[model samples]
Target chain A: MNTITHYSDEIINAFVDGELAAAERRELLAAAAESDRLRQRICEAVQLKELVRGAYPARSPEGLVKGRSGRRGARMRHAAAAAVAVLAVSVALLLPRPEPGQRLADGALSPVLPLSTGEEAGETTRVVFHVSSADPAAARELLDQVELVLREYAAGNRPLKVEVIANNEGLRLLQQGRSPVAERIRRLDQRYQNLLFAACGNTLERLRRETGEQIRILPQAVIVQSGVSFVARRQQEGWAYIKV
Target chain B: MKTMRPYTPFLLLLSLLLAAPLAFAGSDDGPKHKIVIQVSSDDARTQKIALNNAVNLQKALGQDNVAIEIVAYGPGLSLLTSKSRQGKRVESLAMQDITFSACGNTMKKVARKTGKEPQLLEGVRVVQAGVLRIMELQEQGYAYVRP
Candidate 1:
């Protein structure tokens, strides 16, 4: 059986630097498309690169920033000598050991320079949450976790999509009148334009049999399917999975 | 019983010819397919490829049939930079229709650490929630690819 292969640092770095030919790049992409591990590694590498760059914004080359490369180079030389020991210690502690197949964003030989932190400006994202459970508290707890995650991701503009699919016992939170979680869910929905709630029809049938009136799901809940299947299908479809 | 079964063979022949064309015509719309590309990284190199692939897919499927998105979190937000770095590739990608996304949580962390906001490039859109964004897109039936 063939083992799941990861991209080598050289290949990954080459690909990242846009140095690879079209054919090679396509091949690498094909390889990445076929492997989840590769995708994770690539994301990690990219993140590492961005972090590095953000942590250490490249000082404009002497001539570029101030039109004096050699002058700045001489000062950097003296500065390097003084900071060498400290830099080495920090590098050893901070940089993870490069695994054999680990792909570095810049490549194996790329300089290990610290990134300046000033470069980071917040970026926007869209997100959706899936909630399903019989217990209103548990369902609420799931939404709390989701909110926490979203709080971290939204930065300020709150650019995202958040959807909650409640079915079966999960339908209790989304009913129009008697649903306990209705107000809270609706408030979130209003604040987050991308937020939505889906309730499952299959679960509603069972609820109707028991309560005769559709389990009083909050208006915020949109019917879909049982949460587990919904999450599984989503993950299979390529969405990131968070158990909470 | 002695009525007429002569038309049975003729009817069968006619049906076969008509059905033959339908079989060829229906299957030619291409196979039902889906793909997902992972965009959790903000590396210049990975972002470029991710954007290129999105474009390539758009070209192949005329943009509508293919669903393309970039999901960035953590340091991956840097790829959304509209400026050039040591290399000039990222700027070019921003010009493309490629969507660059950053993780809200990560940005907040960076902002706190640096006391500066991360620059969101021209084509970049922020998805305040990374995991949720992925879930929504998946819910919408998009294939995931981590390039």
Candidate 2:
């Protein structure tokens, strides 16, 4: 008896779906004949297929004949087709399977550098503040919230890392000369080395394109390609996200 | 009629077989734990932290077990913008099953200011308002997180 030790679940799935090449199918069948495990796997796949099909039984000839009684027949056929489509979708969703790889906006996945290290490696407390409103009052309020939280952490001498990301209208806060909190930001920057300010490149580009003028950001602010992307990557890293 | 009685058991067995898959498909393990993270800042560090939270939660709960939605609006919407620095990472995590929702209101605001619609990343879904979206998700039993 030949022992098939190398077959992958993907291959078995394809075989069950009748998607395997002729040569592969023959090889799998031969191996199945020798291996109880392989045979059982095939049997289970077959049963699953049968069960799925049975859940949405095909319309019988007698039903079709009866539907031919009038315009209702065509409607019934359409309804049946719709029902089958829905059932197919439900089965697809319920199946345990890996999702297809998603294509990036740039049409390819670019290599990403490891972001967490040194100071960022498993710190006790990490927080991120989101400031997207252009209103000066709103921006200051958010800044206040950050200060309030940081002060609490500071009193405890707890190791903390805080980030403030400004994009869209929130970019108003990071502007070099126009920001109402420019002096306050400069003071904060001088005071806290752990806090970082990030500005959105897309917003700058949009501003330049619209007004035909370059917008200057605060000297302390670091320009990032996309604010949303930055936040998303940070979230994946387990950082706390706060919208202000 | 008497002759058809013997076949009844066989028919019942066949029906049971057919019903099994439907039952399995329709069954819900329990109430799903969901989270909606709000990203309102355009800052890279803030965005990174938000992304990190999502990735960590998925790792802890298993991607199939937990549902996470990151809602971006105002300046934070830039995170979902096409040219974002983290575009590649966003797309990669999205494939891992994270939902990125961009604010339609922010898009309109940006368009008005920039004279062009902000280009969003491929997998990002657009909703009316980021705050409203978060509220709706919360109403639907999702825990709200702002990162």
DockQ of all candidate complexes: 0.12, 0.07
Q: Which residues of candidate 2, in runs, are more than 4 Å off?
A: A1-119, B1-147
Residue B113, model 1: Cα distance from true site in angstroms: 0.5
Off by over 4 Å in 1: A1-147, A150-244, B1-36, B42-44, B82-96
Tell me each candidate's i-RMS in Å: 7.0, 7.6
Model 1 residue A3 lDDT score: 21
Worst 10 residues of 2 chain A by lDDT: A109-118
lDDT string for model 1 (B41-109, tens) is 446777667767776786887644544566766555666544424124444444554445666766776
lDDT of predicted model 1: 0.52
lDDT leader: 2
Docking class of predicted structure 2: incorrect
Write one digit per residue (lDDT tens) for candidate 1, span A20-128.
5676676568646544434554565565556444443331112111221111121234565436545544654465654212332335422221111111112223233
- By DockQ thresholds, what CAPRI class is model 1? incorrect
Chain B TM-score, structure 2: 0.79
